[model samples]
Target: MDCPAGVVTDNYDIVEDDELWARIGIDWSERSERSERSGDGLDNELWARIGIDWSERSERSERSERSGDGLDKVDKLDKLDSETVASPTQRSTSLPPELLRATPLYEALSGWCRHWQGSDSEVELFHFSRPVNSIDVFLNLGVFGVMWKAQWKAYEGQCGSHDWQTSRWMKLVTLFVVFNSQAAALTSLLLSAALGFAEVYVGAHVLPLNLWVFCGYMVFLVQLCFWQRIRSCFVAPWMVFLDKMCIHQTNMPLKQQGIDGLGTFVKHSEKLLVLWSRRYFTRLSLGGTASLVYSVKLL
Candidate 1:
């Protein structure tokens, strides 16, 4: 695709065109329909005020190995991008204190929110939970046949991913995952201990479970693999704009603002995760995802 844009200027002169319209008009129309059923005048007005604002900037090409951004404002946007996202040393959001307190990454994403909203209002960008622990997850798996329901809740809610719950859930999920993973490891170690004692201790020949001692080494290997499986479930560290957490549920004005800013959010995010078979293109054809895909291409 040999895409290019208008003559170079200080800004990129970006346009949402089809992408923003599709998102605001088609994808979000469902919300309007639902609110209409509620029969609340404010609810209807909130949906009535679906605004679309296109703020163009040069996005940093850091997400990929592209040599250059190849467009106007690209250099400026790259500077903003580096300033907005987290650095390797800013500390981890998975930490309880890190999750609650203002950090560089939060500041960066918040800046994007203000830039797009054209307001100084702050919005909470989502963060991922700490790495999962294998030992505990096995104690109870949830609907996906993974971790327990309580544990999963901690990841989604207890981790304090939303603005309202800022400092609320704290590091509960990280602690829980750590506890479960460690607790399971402890049990396995104890079992290995018992098996080892029976096999190696000369005087322990009287042990009734002497036959089971032969599997002691294999148990160590089992524990190793178990930890790896748990690690597989780890959520990568980064803030997201999950609707449940980022949007205002009761405040009509704030809700409307968030609804309107959806396109802005998609456009400015550092990465667009397409790691699933979420009928991605199908959703795009319906409007929103299509905007994201098209915007990336058009740019």
Candidate 2:
């Protein structure tokens, strides 16, 4: 009998039984042979086997290059050395005995006063007065000295940036000088009148003409000295004002800068004035208390 179209016959059984034929369950050996194929069957398997090692090797090489062991050791040493540091030495410079006793503030004031009055004799007299206690002198002198030092340093630093001429410092100095001069004159006249009255009432002997002349000269000198010292006191405020004015002048582009600057100046000035007044009041109170105590003791 003839084989059906889709059925395998005995003659084709041999081809069908072949391994390649068994894969497809067909007998088309001739057609299978004619079909050309290329490429190694093991190529994908081989690539898979080598790819992992290649990636590992690339990673190892990169790590080695980045390690830079020598540089790392040097950096470690620098850090360690920095951490093991030694302490610095202390320095103390002692002032001279005379200077230490006098206090810097007092010296500056005295000097300024002397310069103005063309004589230090009046200051010397006042310096020796009973009411001018040691504590008061020390406090006043020390404070004045410190302030003068600070101001001098500031002046030195700012000299380069500021015009020394036409500075508010000059105006301030002038104002205080004039005010103190008038004050000193009035004080001297009052003192003279009081002394004269006391002498008359107590039947005390009048001072010789020469002594009176000397006292007058000393008073005049002291007045001039006080004027100068007072002028120095005004320097700080003048400097502050000048600084604010300069800032305002320089920052013209900012409309509110000037106003803000002026406000700050006012605030600081108010604070300084308040503090000064407080100190003055405190001193006055202490003086009054001392006077009262002395009067009680006398009575």
In each prediction, how many residue pairs overlap at the backbone (N, C-alpha, C within less than 3 A)?
4, 6
Model 2, 126-243: lDDT tens per residue?
A: 2221211111111111011111111100000101111222333333344345335676777678778866676667645554444454565577567655644455576521222222
**What is the per-residue lDDT of model 1 for residues 1-299, given as tens digits with 9 covering 90 to 100?**
11123211222122223342344453334444543455431233333554312221113223212443233245468789999985422221122222221112222223222322322234333222221221121111101112112211011111111222112122223323433346456756788787667557845556656566645556554443344334335742234334433444456665554444444333333433222222323432223333333334323
For all predicted structures, in order, the TM-scores are 0.24, 0.25
Best by TM-score: 2
Clashing pairs in 2: 104-145, 105-141, 105-144, 105-145, 106-141, 113-225
Model 1 stretches astray by more than 4 angstroms: 1-238, 275-286, 297-299
**CA lDDT of each prediction against the hidden true structure:** 0.34, 0.31
The C-alpha stretches of model 2 lying farther than 4 A from their native spots are 1-163, 166-173, 198-206, 227-263, 267-299
Q: How displaced is residue 251 in candidate 1, in Å?
A: 2.6
